[model samples]
Target: MNRCSFCNRSADDVDTLVAGAGVYICNDCVALSADIIKSKPAGPKRTTPVWEGVDDDALLAHLPRIDAIRHQVDDDLRSWVGEARRRGMSWDRIGEALGMRRQSAWERFS
Candidate 1:
């Protein structure tokens, strides 16, 4: 049984759910959490002006760079996981390293 991230309720079929921050939230908790988080207002802060001068072409040109960066990050993460596994690291250890729970880590990679 997997424990719910929010309430720590034992649950089955947890592999089908999303885990966040050590919580294996059930579907109900997931919906409620989403609603609560969405309803919360952003704190007042210095508002930054939106840049209107940058055209679509410039943004489009950056897509490849962004994609490359994302790919590199993914590859790096995979490499790290491979190394960890090679060194006989436990799922709990990996999850702690990633700031998540062992179940969450397994859900993400397995």
Candidate 2:
């Protein structure tokens, strides 16, 4: 089943949802976000990348943080796929979700 991109609630759990390109948001989240936007003024637009102004030395120093985040996300993906397998979701479905071939998904995660 499809899930909200922000709240992670499945389609069966929400009353309404709108689909965007490769993303989904439910009505509850839309209403909550609208309230948040009303309460806080928008900030200035960021016309440049966040890392654009950083010096080479400072950027190199951030490599460990980025690496750690990547590792954590990798671990999370493995666990999520493992749980989906336990729930009897087919390898084809998993591969489709991951945009890979079923054999590749099984070889990677199984």
Candidate 3:
């Protein structure tokens, strides 16, 4: 059995379910970590790369496109989960990979 690096919970695997880097957390720890990361402010310096000489108007015009792409990505993730389920992957494993509860994964995908 694999043990969670953050909480010592027994698991079948130690792959990074969410949040890359060397953090190997259990399903429960993954959910808590996601919540904490989302709640925190963006911090003083923006981590995203900014294009040199890009005007404010040009950046503003891309917001809608960015939102559309985000929605598409969410849809793709749901479809991927469904496909994974068809291939015999368990909901618990899927939930852990998504940093969510099993019920949450089902509800979100369904």
Candidate 4:
């Protein structure tokens, strides 16, 4: 069975499976990707890749700070999402910002 290239969902789990050039995309990923593409605002998107260079010991030492920072980021995101909604942004647009489907974003944030 083929797995989705993006989310790694197996073909058996999805309602439909699509393949092209040795790559597979399941129905859920397709819908999410479509929403992301269609709802993208007109602008250049910037992505910063994470570097996995930290040693295990160092990572363990930083766990507390990492958890705190993660919580801070979550709180900031919620505040930003609320602000965006107040500014008349659609859930689709918010989902695009968070790299998820509108329904998923609504489920998480609303």
Instruction: Give all TM-scores, in the order shown.
Output: 0.48, 0.60, 0.49, 0.47
Q: Output the number of the lDDT-best candidate.
A: 2
lDDT of each: 0.67, 0.81, 0.67, 0.75
Model 4 Cα lDDT, one tens digit per residue, 1-110: 45665666567888997875445678898899999899999977746433377778877866765555445456657878888999999999999987999999999889
Show the lowest summed lDDT stretch of 10 residues, model 4: 64-73
RMSD of each: 16.7, 9.5, 14.0, 19.2
Clashes of each: 2, 0, 0, 0
User: Higher-lDDT candidate among 2 and 4?
Assistant: 2
In candidate 1, stretches whose alpha carbon ends up further than 4 angstroms from where it belongs are 1-53
- In model 3, the clashing pairs are none
Model 1 RMSD vs true structure:
16.7
lDDT of 3 by residue, 1-110 (tens): 33455555445554443332323357788788899888888758556676555788988876765555455456557768888999999888999998999999888786
Task: State residue 47's C-alpha deviation in candidate 4, in Å.
Answer: 18
Candidate 1 displacement at residue 27 in angstroms? 49
RMSD of 2: 9.5
- As a whole number from 0 to 100, the lDDT of residue 87 in candidate 3 is 96
